[model samples]
Target: MTSRPTPRRAVLTAALAVAAAASPFASATPAFAGASGSGPGPAEGAVDHRAWATFPQWSAGRGAGTRVIGGTRPGLVIGDPIGTHEYRDPHTGTTAAWEYATWLSPVRTLPAPATEVVVSFNARTPAGTWLQTELRGTYTDRTRTPWYVMGRWTSGDAAGDIRRTSVDGQGDGKSSVSTDTLAVDNPASGLRLASYELRLTLYRRPGTRLTPTVWRLGAMASDIPDRFTVPASRPGEGAGHRLRVPRYSQEIHKGQYPEYDNGGEAWCSPTSSQMVIEYWGHRPSREDLAWVDPAYADPQVCHAARHTYDNQYKGCGNWPFNAAYAATYPDLQAVVTRLRSLNDAERLVRAGIPLITSQSFLASELEGAGYGTAGHLMCVVGFTESGDVVANDPASPSNAAVERVYRRRQFENIWLRTKRHNAQGEVRNGSGGICYLYFPLRPTTRQARALASVGVR
Candidate 1:
């Protein structure tokens, strides 16, 4: 029997209310050092910047330890450096450590009709030491005479591995953590908040030698209502965006070309492009896989062009990879400018397109069962009222079974890596101007058949 799609609108509504009730006033403001103004939100097709606040500056600790803020410190740094640590256990002979970092910002009035506030981050084990982290948020009501712990969320990781943690809890403390999912709908106080704080403390077990290094932190604002009900229709239904499946029949197995398998060439973009061509029947004139490599790939060589393409992908492609790819593009300034244009979620909604993509091999072990290490792609067909995204992942083996529903924040972080910023500063592979492709929902029967022939339905 086929599994039924979850009623997202109802689920999101219920989840939001539950979250609000559970964790009443967990605080979140903005990032440190970054001022909160009406700047654009995250770039289009990229993760939205949920809140604005100050960075949790590492205050002086008791013992002698180095404190670094806004930048990297060499070694033995105290407090939170990217939210992880390595410390000597004074009590036991074993080396002890913790991963703790906080993002604090001042609260302006809450967004209109917003029933709750949420916080999210990414935690990973650098050296595979048994590690666990907790997500804590604090909120202080400025109006109240004496500040109180308005709300808090305490939950463990969803999957039991050490790769990373994504925590989502409501004001009432209904939360879960997982490796490749975005945790959202955490409830903060309904009262106007003066300040918000996020903290993570990581420490080694009773007997372990591994130190922790934090990779990413992703947080956002959400509109989880106070009551459970179906969500209103989206702003531009049937008017702007539509889904379209393609048509093609080509037998292209994974290992058909030894050069692709042996890494003789960078196959990520081309392979994806080929999938698009085969699935959609739109082949580019330039058959040579290396056609655009010289002008677009190789960050060291094609810097400016790469940035332009990256920016174009985000601003025009309306896909997350567009913004993500800017991270690797040669020209940093171009990337910044492109990213700046997409500053808010409203703009993305206006675009009438939802960016969708996927990652592979990173969390294969945790992806239930039967799914393979080969990564895949799909579009977010729509959002359910319950704060879940309706996704169309074409590569999954089952047809008609292509549609999936996921928690909004969890899906965003897992698919887009919103929490983990790229340190190497490389363009994301799926961004436009490379291998990524976009299609509307309305398609001819032939196109649909072709898509079905492959794994995309």
Candidate 2:
């Protein structure tokens, strides 16, 4: 094995996983995977997206002491205390008693076997309340995988932060969880997940009325081909269109919050998340920023770095963690999904939704980046008239330098491919066109159609 490690799957040994991203398909999902016609099941294609966000969807879940809410924005909530348990936060070693209730989603079988699965949601976890998401899968051999903890999270620090995080060292001999992704151990073995169910355990301080309301609960299961390069989409489809998103470079705050993911450049995930979040008119309150250094340039960026930091991953690049963090904002919902091509991204971008993409590339591979990264996250704001990619890359030295237009062919190759070569010319994995989408909980009709066209609800 040549010695260059994957920044995302393994960030610490050789280098950190700081990367960029690609686009996807948003075809209408069938009601369930393997179901005829489009229904609520798994999306049928190279990628499958299934979500529960409507009244009927919430009502379908088997809830124990959990209320199926009916309203303009439907969801599930803690109806009554099912039981109590004490949680010892691994990050802080703080133990506390919490009353919890559960909501189990209907099992979804993929139309095609999947090598990886990622779960995300949009929920409001008030102070004294948080949620735990877990996944249990059935393999092609009909054997089942253990329930893997996807995330333990809250939106803000109001409840002492609780240090929202993903668990590590969780896996069976067959499959495992890498940060926010639940994946098969060896796709080469043809051991893929056939079906899976998600569990949401809502927790709150005991002896209180606090409850967590989740409006969007979903997962993306995909079997992306492993390739060194992919066919790029035709250029200039939605050119000359770019949204005005806030720009904050990860390099600017280098060395400021070293405790978070070891500080500095490791913060690309949260930094990119914060930019899109503010573009939608949300920011941390003054009290929220009170802990950050006053002299810091953009306190919100620092705030995001701290809040989205994953103690187990020891970095801020956790995919679902960042999506969950974006959902913490008012009237917002976020999900992590894969896109087929930049054309799909253009559809969403035209609909006023910016995306945070993960990618790895050599400096020589992607023009004008001026640097190579193992893994990095950046915001794709728009496309130029020439069909070039206009992104608010946080890797810049200053905020003003954050916006960049890159060649479509080169950008797509790096962000979309599954296999790549490091500086040492050793082959490694790419992000496989993974991206984070943040949008309104109640979207406009145009936005809804755009999201649906890209296979999101």
Candidate 3:
């Protein structure tokens, strides 16, 4: 086994205390009450509408569909005619749009002593549009009056490729809006359940009607996780020496893979997953790599179509599809069934698992899609107490190694889209229908040996 540094004992001790305090109780009084869009003053406590809504699920390499991870809440529809057709791109005929708006009903109760409320969603804007997608939150108090305009996150401009905008005033050279996290907590309002709506709006020239291709919706809590500090290491210190992994191009060439000139193949999931293993000084047991290779070969295993009608592949390595696939497949029906049964966030926290992904941008996706650009991989490492997901995206030029926090709803919309589950209840490649290998966080010698017997090193 590799000798990785363990988290400080104090940090783990404090986290346990926080977890104990947040345990759910059957007798706990509901937080928010009344109906959605009631009045503006605080209602009862805070009922997270997102948790109760139904979300869509897209088959690996297929188009989008609706489903939720934990509950049976149905997903909302955006654009015209709900849940009928996906928003499509005008120039390329590809689909693009944020998922639908999912909010809690007014009659539902909120978590007890609700002090905060938040809503999040995953968005993928159309290419070449000035604006990618629009997300809005409407917080109503007991009176059904609009209490606050929470904030908005915008992607794109009048014309250009798609980009992600942060609501916290942090973005990658894209126009953005801001929201205050602390303002949502108001004891006096006596708010109960919070209702929210996320719309996938498109933008065109001043008088032109904008069109979008896809849209997704969901919600998460606004409470921040207790902060735990890691032992400080100087820049380029600790495991830095082992972090050097081959670039995507090099990996492809060295592995003797096909040249993706026709934009039909997807390397995003596999490439990114591989980077996480390599950078962390971990290698995929022979079994893990075996599952991954076949998964990448077959495009139909995922939500976004891997190949064009011309037989050219547009695999996960490149744009709109890269973003689209990440958004849709991660939360597919099969995978959600497994995730909903477990407390994922809590389990990861306990296991010290470092989550990661393939975060390709328009430029990278375009280049990779066009068979001209190399791919990039990223990691999602942290979350706030209230469940805001954070990523350690390596694609950003300035903060490549830094953490970027996103609302959990937004993060999950994308993350869930990429998750793959086979018939046997295991993670696999959606396109090729191959089972990917999984390694327990702490493997016993017998388990390791059993894995090796199946050709996993």
Query: By TM-score, who's the top model here?
Result: 2
**TM-score attained by model 2:** 0.89
Per residue, candidate 3 scores C-alpha lDDT tens digits across 1-457 of 0111111101112222424223232133433222232211121112333322223331111122222232332333222322322444433455654333222223323344332333333343344332222233333444332333222223322233323321232221211122312123222233322333333333332222333323333233222221111121112111111123322321222222333322222333444444334433443345424423463432222112221011112223322222222333223210011111012332332233333332211222222122221223344444555555454443322223334555444334223221232224432211100112223423456543433322222
TM-score per candidate, in order?
Answer: 0.33, 0.89, 0.32
Best of the two (1, 2) by TM-score = 2
Error of 3 at 367 (Å): 40
- RMSD per candidate (Å) reads 17.1, 5.3, 17.9
Per-residue lDDT value at 447 in model 2: 82
Query: In candidate 1, what are the lDDT values of residues 181-209, reduced to their tens digit?
Result: 11232333343332233333444332345
Q: Could you give me the TM-score of model 3 versus the true structure?
A: 0.32
Question: Who wins the lDDT comparison?
Answer: 2
User: Which sections of candidate 2 miss by over 4 Å?
Assistant: 1-45, 158-161
Q: Which order, best to worst by TM-score?
A: 2, 1, 3
Q: lDDT score, residue 33, model 1?
A: 13
lDDT of candidate 3? 0.29
For model 2, residues 1-457, the per-residue Cα lDDT tens digits are: 0112234453111211222121122232332221123333222236788899898998888999899888777888999989998899887788988999999999988877777899988888888899999999999999999999999888765655477788888889888887788877766555678899999999988899989899889999887755677876886446778999999988877778667854457788889999999999999999888888788889899888877777777777778878878887878889898877787788788889999998888888889998888888899999999899999999888999999999999999888887777888776778778899999877888788777866687
Q: How many backbone clashes does candidate 3 have?
A: 95
